[model samples]
Target chain A: MKCGLVAADGAVLHRETRPTPRVVVDARGGGRAVLEALLETVVELGQKAAADGHRVRAVGVVVPGIINAESGIVSAENLAWAGTPVLAELKAAIGDQHVILAHDVRAGGYAELRQGALIGTTNSLFLPLGTGIAAAMVVDGSLVSGDGYAGELGHTRFVNGEAAELCACGQWGCLETVASAAALARRYGVRSGRVVDGAREVLELLAQGDPDAEAVWKEALAALVDALVMYTTLVAPTRIAIGGGLVGAGETLLAPLREGVAARLTFQRKPEIVAAVLGEEAGCLGAALMAWDSITDESGEQTV
Target chain B: MKCGLVAADGAVLHRETRPTPRVVVDARGGGRAVLEALLETVVELGQKAAADGHRVRAVGVVVPGIINAESGIVSAENLAWAGTPVLAELKAAIGDQHVILAHDVRAGGYAELRQGALIGTTNSLFLPLGTGIAAAMVVDGSLVSGDGYAGELGHTRFVNGEAAELCACGQWGCLETVASAAALARRYGVRSGRVVDGAREVLELLAQGDPDAEAVWKEALAALVDALVMYTTLVAPTRIAIGGGLVGAGETLLAPLREGVAARLTFQRKPEIVAAVLGEEAGCLGAALMAWDSITDESGEQTV
Candidate 1:
C-alpha cells in the first residue's frame, strides 16, 4: 500500500510504502483483515503527521477496485473486497477529517491531468498497461467516473478469430487478454517453453532477437493499437498517456502504436501518443490532491 | 429542415419544415446555397414568431455534422458544409436574438434526458440507428461533445473476419456498415437479389419469414449486440434508448438486442434497452430547451 501526506501546493510532505495484508480469501470474511490494515495505516499516518509538527486536514484513499462514491462501498476481486464499507471505517479510524475515496487509476489520471503528461489538454486518456489494464478517461475537462464503472477499456474486445484468448473478466478476446504486461510474459513463456521473470525479461529477450519474445511483443502491440483506435473512434481524445509497466519499454511500445493507429485512422482526429510522467507515485499524489480540492471546494479558497 | 417555435415551458407554439435547396456539391462553393437556404429559414421563422404575438428572444439550430462550438463552424458531408460558419450566418440573419447551435443527435438526447425516456437517469445512451448511425452519450449527467467528435459508436469496428465490409468512414466492418437502416435495405437487396423500399420493407419481409431478410436482420442484431456490450463494458450506462427509423420495427429490433446483450454480459452492468419516446421531434425540442437554458443560466432565472 502506498500512502503519503501531500500539501495543498502539490508538495509531498511525507511518503512511505506499507505491505498490504494477505489472507486466505474465502467465505469466512477474510477481507476484514485487509480492511483493518487499511484503517490502521490511516490512523498511524495521522499520528505521524502530528508528531512531525504538521496538521492533517484531510485524507484521500485510492484503491484498485470499483468504488461507489454514494455509499462508500468498494468491490475488488484481488483484495477479496465485495461491497466493503471502506469510507465509514476510515472515518471512524480518523475522526473529524474530510475523507475522499477514489479508484487508483482515476486518481493517477487526475494527477496526470493536473501536473503531468496530460496537462493543458481537455479530452485525453490515461491508459495504464500493468498486470491488468484499465483507462482513466478525461472527457471535456473532467475525469469520467460513470459512477465508478467507466474506463474499463482493457475488458473491451480487441482480439478475434482462433487467436482469441479467454479474459479473466469472463469476456472472450478482451484487450487485456492479449496486451497486458502479465499476458506478454505468460505468452512468451508458453510460446518458447521457457519461463521469463516478467515482461521485463520478455523485453530483454526481444532486445537480443529472441523469436518467441518478438512474437509475444508483436501480439501485444497489435492488440494495443486496436484498442487505441477503438477508443479514438468512440471518444475522440486529444492525447493519450500510456503508463504502467509496459511503458518502461519506452519507444519500443509507443513507436509501433503511433504508426499502427495513424495507419488505421481515416476521418478521426489524431491524438498525441505519449508516456505518463508521474510513474507509480501518481495514485498516492492524486489522492492527496483530491483531498486538498475537497477542502478548497467547500471553503472556496484557492489553495493550489 | 424541421423548425419550431417552442415556448419556455416546453410547448410547441408553431412548427414547420422547409425543403433544403438542392445544389450540385462539386466545385465553386455549392455549399454556399445550402447555407443561404438555412439563413433564410431562420430569418422567416423569427418574422413569423414576431407576427404571431410572440417575442423571439432566442433561436436554436441543430444539424447533422461535426460542430466546432468554439468557432461555430460546421462540417456535414451530406450538406456539403466543410468548415462553414453556420453560427455566424445564423447570428447575422436573425439580428440580435441569441442563437444556440448544436448537434442534432446530442440535441435529441438532451430532450430525452429532460422530458422523455431517459429522464431521471444520469448515465445513458441515445442511439439512433438511422440511414447513417451516430450516438448521443450522456456520461456522468452531461452530454459528451468531445469537441463534436464523440459518440461515433456506429463507426467503431464490430463486424470482423470475411464478412467485414468497407465502411464509408474508410474503416472495415464498422457497426454502421451492418446495423444502420440504410445498411439493412442495401444488404437485403444484395442477399435476396430484390430491391426494397427501405428498412421498413425489410422488417415486413422478416415478419413473413423471408430467409434473406431474416439473415440480414440477424446479422444486424449480432453486430448491435456486440457494440452494446462493448459500450456497457466501457461506459456503464444504466439505460439505452434506441431511436431513428430502425426503431420503427419496435420489438423486432429491441427484443433481440436485449436478449443478446444479456446473454453476452458477465461481469459488466447490464443496461435496460428501450425505444426512444420523442421520435422525430426530439432534436427540435432539445434545441429549444438548450436555448432557454442558456438564457436562464446567464440571468439566474428558474424558467423550467
Candidate 2:
C-alpha cells in the first residue's frame, strides 16, 4: 500500500508505495492469533520501509471499535480483540520511532479540519455515514478526543412509532440503522428481496421519482437531519462535513439536509453542511497529521 | 438581592446584600424600554459596588435565549430584546470596567465545572432543564462556548408516534416541551385539570407510584436519557451535572435516569450522572469567576 505523511497544516512531506503483506484471518485461533497477525503486519511493514531507505518515524493503523488513545489500547468488538496494545506493538516493530494510534473517524476529522471542507474553521464536525455512522470533532483548532471515546453519533436512538430496527451495537432504532448507506440498501432489500449494489442505485431511483425510493430517501434524510440538528445545537460548529458512500449523491443529499436543519433551528446558529474533501483518503491523511502533531511542540489554546 | 463573589476554586471572598428593586413591566412599551430598564439596573448595581470601594473590575450579567458572549449581544424571544448590546451598555455605565455577558445555562456550567459537582473532572456537561433546555460544556478542562451559540440542547427534536407538540421555539416535539420542569407541570395540569406546583410535585407523586405520574415521569426520563445518550456519544464527557428546577427532584430523577442510560449503552462508557452543586447561585458564581478571570494576567486557562 502507498504511504503518505501530511502535517496538521496540510503539508505533504513524503509519499512512498510498498506492498503490504496479506493479513491472515484465523477464526479457530481466536483473539490471540488475531493480535499476532496484526503484530506481524507491523513488523513486515517496518522492514519494507527500512529496506526502501525510509525512517518510519511513526505508524498509524486504523481498526474498528472503542479506542483509548491515552492508554494506547484498542477495544474492537468486531476485530475479536479487547484492549490490544497497538501503540506498544507498533513501537516494538519500528524500533524506537514515535507511534501514533487513533480511531479512523477521528483521523478523518483531523484531515478534514486541516485540508478539507472544514479548512480554516476552528469548530467543525466530520460525519461519515458509510457501513456505520460516526463523527469526529474539531473544536478550538484541535481534534477533540475526550477520554478517547468521543464521536459515537451513530448510536443515538431515534424512536419513531412502534416499529424499531435493532442496531449492531444491540440498541433499537439507532440513527445508524436508519440513515447510513447500508441502511438505505438494507431497507430496500428487505422490502423487495432484491439485493442492490449500493445506496447509489436507490439514490438514482429516488432522483427518477420512484415512490419507494423517495420514501426511503426521505426517511434517511430526516434521521440524518435529526442527528445533525441535535449536534449543531450542542456544539454550534462553523461547518459540518459529510463523508462516506452516501455523500456520493452530492447535492441531492446536501440540499435537503440543509433545508431540514434550517427549518428546525430558531435561535441556534446554523452550520454550513457540505461534502467532505478528502473522501476515502481522509483517515490516512488525518493519521499522518496526528503523527506529526504528536511529535511537534505546539500550544493548544485557541478558542473555537 | 445579596451578592457574593465566588472564585473558580470555590472561594467566596466577598459578600453583600442589597434590596432588589422592583422594575415595571410594560408589554406595550416596546423592546427599547426593556433594554433601557435592564441597563439602568446594571448601572445602579455597578455604581453601588464602586461606591463601596470595590474595584468593580468587570460585570457578568446573564439572561436567557441565544447569547453571543464574545460580542456580549443577547437575543431572546421571550424577552423583548433582539441583538441587544449588553456588554457595551454595561461598559458605558461602569466606565473603564470590562464587562462579560453570557447565557444563564453556560454560566451555570462554568460554575459547576469550576466549583461545584463537576469539579476535578476534565470533561463534563452542565444541563439545566428548566422552562427550556440548555447546556454548558467543559471539555479538556476548559469551558466550550463554540461561537458563543453552543448549548441549546432542548431544541433537539424527538419524534414519538404520530403526535408532535409544538415547542415555544416554534419547533415540533422538542425535548424541552416534553421533559422540562415547566413541561411536567403543564402536561399534568392539562390531563387532570388540577395545576401541580412544579416538577417536585410530579416527583413526589411518582415516588408514591401514582399511575398517572409514573407514566408522565417515565416518558420524561426516557426523553432525557435519549438526549443524554446523544451528548455522551458526541463529546464523551466524564460526567454530567444536571441542574435547574427539575433537578430539585433529587434521587427521584437521578436513580431512574442512571438506569435508563445504562440500559441503552452496549459498548460506550457510561458517564456519572449527578446533581449540580452551588444550587441557584451557580450562575452568579460563574459570572464572578469570569469577572476575576478577565482581570487576572494568567493564561486564562480554567483550572478545574
Candidate 3:
C-alpha cells in the first residue's frame, strides 16, 4: 500500500509503503486482515504527523473495489472484501473526523484531473493497463461514478470469434484479456513456449525485436485501439490518460494506440492520448484531497 | 411533425401536425427551408396559444443532430444543418422566457424519464431502433448530454473483420448497419433479392416463416445483443427502454433481445429490457417539458 501526507497545496511532506496482510484462512475471508492493515497504517501516519507538528484533518482511503459512498461498504474480488464496512471501522478508529472512501482508479483520475495529463478537460477517460483493467470516466466536468458501477471499459469485448479468451470477470473477449500488463506477460509466454519474469521481461524482449513479443504486442495494440475507438464513439471524451504498469513502455504503447484510434475515428472528435503524470503516487494524493474536500475544517469537527 | 403545448403538470393542452416543406435547389442547403418552417411553426403556435388565452413561457425545440447547448448551434446531416444558429433564430422569432435546444432522441428519453418507463429508475438507457439507432443514457438520476456528443451507441462498432460493412457515419460495422429499422428492411431485401416495402413487411414475412427474413432478423438480434451487453458492462444501467418503429413487432423483437443479452452478460448487472410507452409524440412532449424547465415561471400573462 502507498500511503502519504499530502498538504493542502499538493505538497508531499512524507510518504511510505507497507505490506498488505494476507488472510490466513480463505474460509474466514481475507477482508478483515486487509482492513486491519489499512487501519494500522492510518493510525500510525496520524501519530507521525502529530509528532512532526502537523495536525491531520481528514482521512482518505482508496481501495480497488465498488464503493457504496452512502453505506461506506466496499467489495473487491482481489482483496477478498465482500460488502466490508470499511467506512464504519475507519470512523470508529478515528472518531469525529471526515473519512472519504473511493475507488483507487477514480482517485488516481482525480489526481490527474487536478494536476496531471487530464487537467482542464471536462470530458475525458483515465484508463490504467495494470494486472487488470478499468476506466475512470470524466463526463461534462464530473467523474461518472454510475452508482459505483460505471467505467469497466476493459471488460467490454474487443477480440472476436475463436481467438477470444475468457476474462477473470467470466466474460469472453474482454479488452483486459489482451491489452493489460498481465496479459502481455501471459501472451508472450504462451506464444514463445517459454516463461519470463513479467511484463518487464516482455518489454525487454520487444526492445530486442523478438518475433513472439511483437505478435502479442500487435494483438494487444489492436484490442486497445478497438476499445478506445468504441469508447470515443459512445462517450465522446476529449482526452484519455493511459496509466498503470503497462504504461512503463511509454511511447512504445501510446504511439500505436494514438495512430490506430486516429485512423479508425470517422465523424467523432479525436481524443488526445497521453501518459499519466502522477504515476504510482496518484491514488494516495487523490485520497488526501478528497478527504480534505469532504469536510471544511482543520478543527477535527465533522461537517458531514 | 407532432407539435404540442404541454402543461407543467405533464398535460398536453394543445397538439397539431403540419406538413414538412422540402428544399428546392440541389446547390442550396435544405437547412434554411427547414429552419424557416420551424420558426413559422413556433410563431404560429404562440399566436394560437394567446388566442386561446394561454401564456407562452418557454419554447423547446428538439432536432435530429448535435445541439451545441452553449452556443445553441445545431448540426444535423439529414436536416442539412451545419453549425446553424437555431437557438438565436428561435429567440428572435419568439421573445424567449426560456428557449431549449435538444437532440430528439434525448428529448424523447427525457419525456420517458419524466413520465414513462424510466420514471423511477435513476440508472437506465432509452434506446430507439428507428430508421437509425441512438441512445439516451440516464446515469445517477440525470441524463448524460456528454456536451451533445455522448450516447451514439449506434455508431459504435459491433461487427468486426470481414463481416463489417460501411456505415453512413463513415465508420465500418456499426450496430446501426444491422440493427436499425432501415437496416432490417435493407438486409432482408439484400438477402432475398426482393425489395420489401419497409421493416413492417419484413416483420410480416418473418411471421410467415420466411427463411431470408429469419436470417436477417437473427443477425440484427445478435448485433443488438452485443450492443446491449457492451452497454451494460460499461455503464451499469438498471433498465433499458427500447423505442422506435422496430418496437411495433412487440414481443417478437423484445423477447429475443432480452434473452440474448441475458445469456451473454456474465458478472454485469442485468438490465430489464422493456418497450417504451410514449410512442411517436415523446419528442414533442419532451421538448415542451425541457422548455418549461429552463425557466422559473409562467406569470399568467397571455403575451405572444
Backbone clash numbers for all candidates listed: 0, 0, 0
DockQ of 2: 0.71
Q: What TM-score should be assigned to candidate 1? A: 0.97
Ranking by DockQ: 1, 3, 2
| Per-candidate TM-score against the hidden true structure | 0.97, 0.89, 0.96
Model 1 C-alpha lDDT per residue in residues A196-290, reported as the tens digit of each score:
89999999999999999989899889888888988998899999999999999999999999999999998888999999999998999889888
Candidate 3 CAPRI classification by DockQ: high
Interface Cα RMSD of candidate 2? 1.3
Which tens-of-lDDT digit does each residue in B121-178 have in candidate 1? Answer: 9899999999988999999999999999999898999877788999998999999999
Put down candidate 3 lDDT per residue, B196-262, tens digits, no spaces. Answer: 9999999999999999999999999999999999999889999999999999999999999999999
Full candidate order by TM-score, most accurate first: 1, 3, 2
By TM-score, the best candidate is 1
lDDT of 1 at B219: 92
Off by over 4 Å in 2: A5-56, A204-211, A297-304, B1-3, B6-10, B13-54, B159-161, B204-211, B297-304
lDDT of 3 by residue, A133-229 (tens): 9998888888878777888899999998899999988989899999989999999999999999989899999999999999999999999999999
Cα error, residue B32 of model 3, in Å, equals: 0.8
